[model samples]
Target: MATGSVKIDVHHITRVEGHGNIVVDVKNGQLKQCDLEIPETPRFFEAMLRGRPYMESSHITSRICGICAIGHATASLRATEKALGVEPSAQTVLLRKLNFHGEMLDSHILHAYMLVAPDLLGAPSVVPLAKAAPDVVLRALRMKKLAGDLCAAICGRHTHPIAMTVGGFTHFPSKADLEALRQRLIEARADVDATVELFQKLKIPAFERDTEYIALSKPDEYCFIDGVIKSTDGGSWPVEQYRQVTNETCVKHSSAKRTRHQRESYMVGALARVNVNFDLLHPKAKSAAGALGLKPKCVNPYMNTVAQVIEIAHCVEDSIQLCDVLLSRGVTWEEPVAPARLSGEGVGACDVPRGTLFHNYVIQDGLVSGANCIIPTGQNLNNIEADMRALVPAILDRRPEEITLSLEMLVRAYDPCISCSTHMLDVKFV
Candidate 1:
């Protein structure tokens, strides 16, 4: 190992959701300080949910992230519905799953194409990649547009959805709209295959560290909207026990709180989900994973990008099936289910594009008396640091620029939404 005094100070990393700095120091062949410092201010989403009417939490908290807004809204609605003792109809469930698939396609494509692809392609950003690989960029844009339109057709818009409510949706997609979307999804398989091939050609760094993986787990299907919180560490918990699994605590360097469960840190996202639920993936997605050389129990953080691409295939294929199911059953208009009771406590969990997200609510007198939202990025922050601590030393022999790039790629592999992670604090300032 050829290491003297080395310091890497990235003022702010690019190609992520929000602000964060990577600060590393190594002295005389000895590692010293390494931290992924998050400086984004806390967003107080939980506090804002307090005292809001039960019907409003979904719409309000969806603003937590423009990218994962549908995920947030879905989780928020689940929590509200459970708290108020409202069970969604079967039709509602199918539509919500399709809507969730739209977001999964939108976000995974955005990250895999616009954010993480630049690093693998040796470009500064997607702007350069667009010029150099116009066809590739156009494919990404095409898929993204389809995903957004899918969301708009069902949920009224891609960003913060307007139609989804506590028990059901305000509007349903027309048969023509659903049929058109189904056709488009069927056509997108070639693009998804191209995406897999592109990543297969690009070399991901060879790095691996065994860490615990966690995500929402369902026995019958690959999970997203609802499942138990399952961990690779060999335990499962209901959504209500998420606090025990998360164990979020404040750290000195980051405004975002660090989380741990059964280990110093654990991972939650595409890699984790793929590891925890690989057998449950759709056959096409499994083929994509096979093509990308991604298999269960994958430990390399960089391969998270690869897993995301696999999920895109899954989303497209699954979306087509969902469209078929909906068409066969026929879309029927139904009134939103009213709350059977207004006083209860409930927790909701969803496997978003990022990872397992949890929302807990306490309802009293038809209003939200308390709320807690554990973001996927927040859950992954500590694991990122853990990965960094392991990775920095292994690559210390490389030049500073190379080291910095490796670290940047490591962070981007998580596809973190930092602003969403920094949502809530347990401190009171005088």
Candidate 2:
């Protein structure tokens, strides 16, 4: 708010998971309040996990987000495995990495093509893109299909995977099967490169906000399946210490809780990962990042879309490398990871598509006694609104449609899976 009055109320932002709204109130050039309100009824996924058997918790929590089903399931499995004192074999870890890479590819391609592409292309949705940029749309579809097939090969289903379990997969893909999938991945590299080049041409706004970045960090490579929680402010903690870093608090404007570290806001997802671990990116992804003019320590929220494009390249190359390792070592079909009756607490932390996700569990005699799952979207809720607060003021002089588009694009950049985080609240009458 500077010289005039404006009101922007956008309900249920399009091309994102679940429902979210942007609300802004300004009067006489004074900012009253600006918020991204997710008033969706809390989904209560935590409560659902409680009292469920360790083997069933992943299957139950995997329902939190249709787009991120594998991430949720992976987190749940890691937590259950840890609490039950189960350690997966080397082959299991490698296979899980493959599954993780596939999840990343699946979600990133969907966001880049189906959700974020229309905004840059000036199309209402992907439907029009089919008519306008038929080849581009077709390529995106092929990329998505290829990634989905990888999931099916590894997890036994494209959407909600059935093969993943507590300590290991119920079924492992044969060498011949993995080799086939590897060939498809190798073939898809050209398309992934095209995607990076495509996003490079998009018109992303130039806006910068200095904030803390958080993600899972490892010493050897870009972490996906496991790593310690890290913050850009030089704070490092184990997954079980998440309560200290997240410092989650309730806000009346949204059902999803907001998170903060040393500052009022912190960013997660691809941007944070790139900011922290750019060196570990696969060679192909690193080249894509350079081509797109993206470098480490990027602070612009709008560049998150670019970061995602870079991440797509990384996931693809990483997937190929994982395939090489699996084949060289040879895969073995081991017994499904079965958990023994135990009483303890454990936390599973991993880099999901949206960002770093944590699933903490307290198990009593092999049944989940309590659960807490922190999703990337939930962590970035405060940051998104904070970006909005900064953005609307800068573009207040622009047209209303421009303002709305800016805000909507900001949210879409997060590729938020709102449904994954909605169920983490408890309310009582005051």
Candidate 3:
């Protein structure tokens, strides 16, 4: 048995969506190597779009990740439209933003209740939590179900949406449907407040690193649907100039590519969004952030989970407001925006639940000639490794079990969808 050194190989971390290995080796307290290895094979989502009709591109790419199906679909449609130079109507933009909020609520609820709750409560899984804290679990299930209904009302399905298209939705939700969803969200406000209270009492670990943060930002609001890519390092770039900032390079250990922006590693997702666009958050969400002691330039990665909590407040309230507007305007049956020409190229950047997602496409003669997607988890992989590099040595004196749990919790904090990041590294627009 090795006594003076620590050797840990946590193969396939639990609770996260896909396979990854966390390998750390320390010999006589001298750090040897620590790597968060992405061993899963790549899924070539972009290549699949080749030769497909531009209309079908959104449908095919929406299958990229079940949790981020709306994000993928939204980004894909935006790219398709930009290529064809057809601007969506004001109603279309409103409904699409609402559609994304539904996904944010649904996906965040799962991460908070189903995944992170077990770790926080010292339970093995949500199954045990159902017995240990049935009320808490029930609230989550109710909220999740309601959120799913919101998405389905707008997009025709939750997991893989069908109604949303490149130019606009096939049809808008009925007045009755919007009214019912508004009522459900009103009823769920108490549940969201309960969640805030829960997070307020839980003890999150203390760890901080001043990493560069990036997200999409636009005028007068938090731009989830459309924006320029802005970095906290005081650099902002157009969506088309994404490659200049991403600087994505293939790595030996990760099937997912590593990325850097203005520094060695930068973070994305809720924390980055909060850090960059704190002023634009809904008042309730801003209040939640204030209560949680999460201010701008917050360096602690663990607080990413807290940022997510704050966003739940925002998503619910914003969705309600969106619903009110849609109801007042009245739902209307509209056809998808027709393309001006078959040959064009465009790129889209949008804020998802996790972070900024990029989709670039070239439509040649009514078919998608090429495509590329940049995933949030892919951007965070290097940042997570950087955190581990700093963390392990500080906690080396602690028991092995404690160290292992801390690392796992750190990864869980990001709420990473690994399979979503398993996109191919080498992509060339045709």
Candidate 4:
């Protein structure tokens, strides 16, 4: 009889936001089990939101995730607009896309340089990268700042901007302000180019798992702002029908709800979006995707960082085009009508940097009666665990410390935002 035993566990993961754990058990020459746990702590975001004025939902929900504040805010606004029965003007849509792109860029850079790259480069943190390659670190900072500036210009603040509203922005950007942003984005094109090259050269782990990819899709052009929910397996449903496709259920072991579609776990985020809408990507984005060797469907989760960099370039290029359109036509703003009687249900979804985010609302009178928010992290949780399962057997022979590091690195590759996943709850590990 053969006998062996190994166990790897991470009690508290640092350097990445939120709280979570990875546990692996090996026995008798076969992997025993792998469990990913999210501790439950109740924040009561939905319960507290009950009876709040519809206009305030954006501000309130924006608190759900600090890392993706703009995403939450944008989702809230879209829901409120649906409840209020208003479609924002063209300029409003463009401006909102710009703000979202900035947030996406900020998030992608943070994940690429700060979270994921360190592991690939064998560094504990980006601090070492900052010392060894000051220029690289500085470029990341500059790119991040550009994203912040774009967010500030559109929403009045980078972290938790309050300028976004249901109908349209509370304020509009001046021509000079818009022009300055345009020029800055134009100048930063080279930086974006460099970033693409930098990510392409990084060595990523070889762990490939196939899962259904989901993202928003439109008939023409990349569907970043609005579109029906689409999947790589040729399954799609309207945005309003997302709940029918996505079923969230509670697991005894996890504080975060496990999401599955048709009884199978699925994947979302940059790779999913890139896979589902490769044809719809902006021309420059298409070029970058080609350069990165990303196909119509990308299965390796580790390559998500590369897809994110391609997306950054796409967003910057798209922003420049949007600015050109805005400058040529001049700035225009219009306030939409507020729905007086709001007894209805509506759904809204957008392509955040991580993945597809869905928001559903049940409104009564002029207040939000019930709200359900499905973030990308929740969708990717099961997939992350599955990847960990596949990775453990291969690394079981390695030292415990090495095994732990590999497991943690795999988690970071998903770029899981635990705060966003458990927005309505407080996390506590038992």
User: Tens digit of lDDT per residue, candidate 4, span 1-430?
Assistant: 1246776667766656688877677777577768777774646777877898888888988888777889988887887778768777888888888888899989999999888877877778999978887787899999999989989988898788888988888878889989999999999999988987887788877778788888889988677666889888777898888777678888766778888875378888888888888887788888888887777777888888878888888889988988898899898666754664567666778888878888778888887899988888888888887887777777767777877887787777777888778731111112
Off by over 4 Å in 3: 1-3, 424-430
Find the number of clashing residue pairs for candidate 1.
0
TM-score for each predicted model, relative to the true structure: 0.98, 0.96, 0.97, 0.95
- In angstroms, the error of model 1 at 147 is 0.3
Question: What's the ranking of the predictions by lDDT, best on top?
Answer: 1, 3, 2, 4
For model 1, residues 16-87, the per-residue Cα lDDT tens digits are 988888888888877788888888889898999889898889989999999999999999999988888899
Q: How many clashing pairs per prediction, in order?
A: 0, 1, 1, 5
Q: Which candidate has the highest TM-score of all? A: 1
lDDT of 3 by residue, 1-430 (tens): 2336887778788888887778888888877877888878889989999999999988998999999999999999999999999899889999999999999888889998898888888899999999999998999999999989999999999898999998999857899999999999999999999999888887888998889999999878877877899989997889999998788998887899999988999999999999999999999999999888899989999899889899999999999999999998987888877888889999977888889899999999989999999999999988998998898888888777777788888888888888999841110101
Candidate topping lDDT: 1
Error (Å) of candidate 2 at residue 389 is 1.0
The C-alpha local distance difference test score for the whole of candidate 3 amounts to: 0.88
Show pairs that collide, candidate 4: 41-425, 41-426, 42-426, 269-354, 269-355
Worst 10 residues of 3 by lDDT: 421-430
Error of 3 at 301 (Å): 0.8
Better of 1 and 3 by lDDT: 1
Candidate 4 achieves a global lDDT of 0.80
lDDT accuracy of residue 156 in candidate 2: 94
